[model samples]
Target: MKVLVFLLLIITTITSKGWAQDCLGMTLKAGTSYEMSTFNAKDKPTGKISYQVKDVHKEGSSTVMDITAQFEDEKGKQRTPYVIHYTCTGNELIADLSGMMQSMQATAMKDAEMKLKSNKLVYPGKLSVGQKLSDGQMEAEMVSNGNTMMNMNMVMSNRQVESKAPITTPAGTFDTYKIKSDMSFESRVMGIPIRNSMQVVSYRVDSQIFDIKSETYNKNGKLMGYTLLTKAN
Candidate 1:
């Protein structure tokens, strides 16, 4: 449903990161935290996502960061928190998509047996205008009491670095790369099939583990919602 779409959009926007290479200008540090506020099309506050860096270490040639993330509604009622990992190498940064399922587990698919498989999201160290990025995909199934409840599939494609820009948020002003991508979602609940698609425009700063801002739009280019970084430390 709509909740599922919003959760997927939140996951995509929050998972981008970087390191100390052309693609990354700095490394993730422990004890750092960031908060992003979500708003509806009318700019009404809806929910929030918070992240805390819990650990950072080296794994062979990669730097790995463990982060705890929590989602809360407008009223401050929080869902279950979960851990997600980000891996940074000299060439690019990658985010594990498996952890994203936890959001659904806390909402739409509560108490349902779930299975998920996904391709990690990648951000190349050297982003330039017009650079085409790799696509990402995810598929999941939920079952309960020996009956299939829902099956979902999502694809993010047409990714490209559109330009460099400065964006200002509650956290502060940041020099960022403006990236664009298209997303499609398909789900089957009971015997009915539902499909949705949207376009996302996100602004990310070098050396940061989160986006400065992200906007979602419907197929006709109407703004649907947006998320903005409100705090960082």
Candidate 2:
């Protein structure tokens, strides 16, 4: 989601009992560091983002990985730090918007209350090259100064594995799967209502936490922008 503006990723070094190369990318090795970069539609450098795996734990059916994310402007100035949680289903990664967004708002806003209700996207184990997957809806609200300042609802559907190919980035080259999805966003920010649709593309490296590259396209199919996993270890 919106917090992904900096970077979108799933982190863990542990592999589920029955899951391996096909379903999830990146077995999270805790204490490791990784970095990603963001770019505008014009291909201009936007910002730099980095993350470190803080901890990993097994909680019943879910494997919980904690990550600390740091942001920097194009000037390389540091931004506030954010702590995010990525939960795995013994097999594949699941996108939990509430944890993602709450961590984002907590770092970016002071005294802001953010609430997110979401349906998650499940990435399957033994990923098939042409498989289609569906994620769910997320509704988020931000309250400040005793008033509702922002409300957003996003629906992700029509999701699928579009293709598989070798991808090269500054971090390294990867045998990656290209995942695609359609998203609709309706929101009211500062009392301004906005509606938009987007096309999402992610190139995920086998067993990696985050995609090597991610793109967002507008309704007209014009490039809205993209982000990339530029570095990792």
Candidate 3:
């Protein structure tokens, strides 16, 4: 039973299906663009991030995603990355944020990978309106080389992520579901070997159109950070 549950979570996280009409088969619409207007913890509307995506090419069963974005950092400086590469196999998705990280000192990429693995949250089969996917129940530990990281148990769910980032203008809003999950991982930063339980809440949104919104929150149930789909080709 435990193995079955874990396998399901892995599949859901890896596949992350949806966007059949907009993304699959057809190439990304040329000149596609969008923007993310971020908000601080106070929810005070802050700066903005803009992206332009182009479909470089398609190979076999994968669609190549080329993305670039411009945003202001905490120090109020405007910066943009060259481009981030991502690919989608059917409904599964993968992104490379290392390029973006070069300009900004954010831990977003690392956090994203961890969140992807930990949350294991995605739509069950296809992407559509009013569809929901529950990972049922999962319990595991962060292990490395047969060493214990942390023991955790959680129920992860995923719905359609809506994108509200604007295209014509360089600003917009994104809204998504509040994911209520629980998990534990080895505390590498904390330098602790003890197990700790965390009640995880990941914020996300789906737009009226086809863009997706995804964000991460701390245990306080506040928006610690987020990921936005600013553009698609």
Candidate 4:
């Protein structure tokens, strides 16, 4: 159960960055970097994730960005680093789930082989209050030797832009759209099924590579944790 909770925290930390580029407006430059700091329900500092844009290129009409990510404990100990990719095309941006799985494999399931099938997360170039967004899903199975040891699934649904607001973080203040979504996770480990659900609210600036802030809440509407953009360059 503890392992599952830790994995969930890591996922939340990653996704809170918004994963969308300012398609049609701004280009992501290589060597750009950002950091997000995570906190627990009690607002206690937990850890932080750092991201650096390593490469940017054009794939026909699409702009692809390769970003390297690393997580560090509150005490400043670093973990294994991984890379993720994001793409921008036409009026939309997409975040690749396969890149996210690489981080998960390196951070949580090091010894097991993971097979993933995922629907990538999407964000439109323009967002409006009350606009509904598409759902995202991912399924992963962990195998050891010839036996499947765990099956995990996650779904993000009911996504909508709630409002436009100003959000302040250590990185600075920005005009952002507040987006809300319901997130659920289910996993079967050694044949025992476990389920968890939460609500996520993220403040996203259209021109920024990282979100200003994101908060998670329990089913009862109690704050569970949060991630804040602490630095950007």
TM-score per candidate: 0.88, 0.82, 0.47, 0.89
Q: Which pairs clash in the backbone of model 1? A: 23-125
Model 3 lDDT per residue over 1-233, tens place: 22212111111101112222244433454346666555444655445566666444566876665666566544677754545555556665444433332332232222222222332233222333344445433333344445553343444333332322322322344444444444443323224544333343334333222234334344466554433444433
Per-residue CA lDDT of model 1 for 1-233, tens digit only, reads 56654555475422234332222676466777889899988999989988897777777988887888888889999988877888889788888766667667667678898787674788887778899999977788888998989888888899999999999988889988999999888888896999998898988866777788988888899998889999988
Candidate topping lDDT: 1
Q: What 10-residue stretch in candidate 1 is worst by lDDT? A: 14-23
TM-score of 4: 0.89
Sort all candidates by TM-score, best to worst.
4, 1, 2, 3
Q: What is the C-alpha lDDT of each candidate?
A: 0.79, 0.69, 0.40, 0.78
Off by over 4 Å in 4: 1-22
Task: List, in order, the clash count of every candidate structure.
Answer: 1, 8, 12, 0
> For model 4, how does the per-residue alpha-carbon lDDT over 97-195 read when each residue is reduced to its tens digit?
555566667767788998887747788888889999999777888888979888888888999999999988888888899999998989888999999
Model 3, C-alpha of 156: deviation from truth (Å): 11
Model 2, range 95-160, lDDT digits (tens) per residue? 555555655576656587987766465666546678988676778888898899888777778878
In model 4, where is the ten-residue run with the lowest total lDDT? 13-22
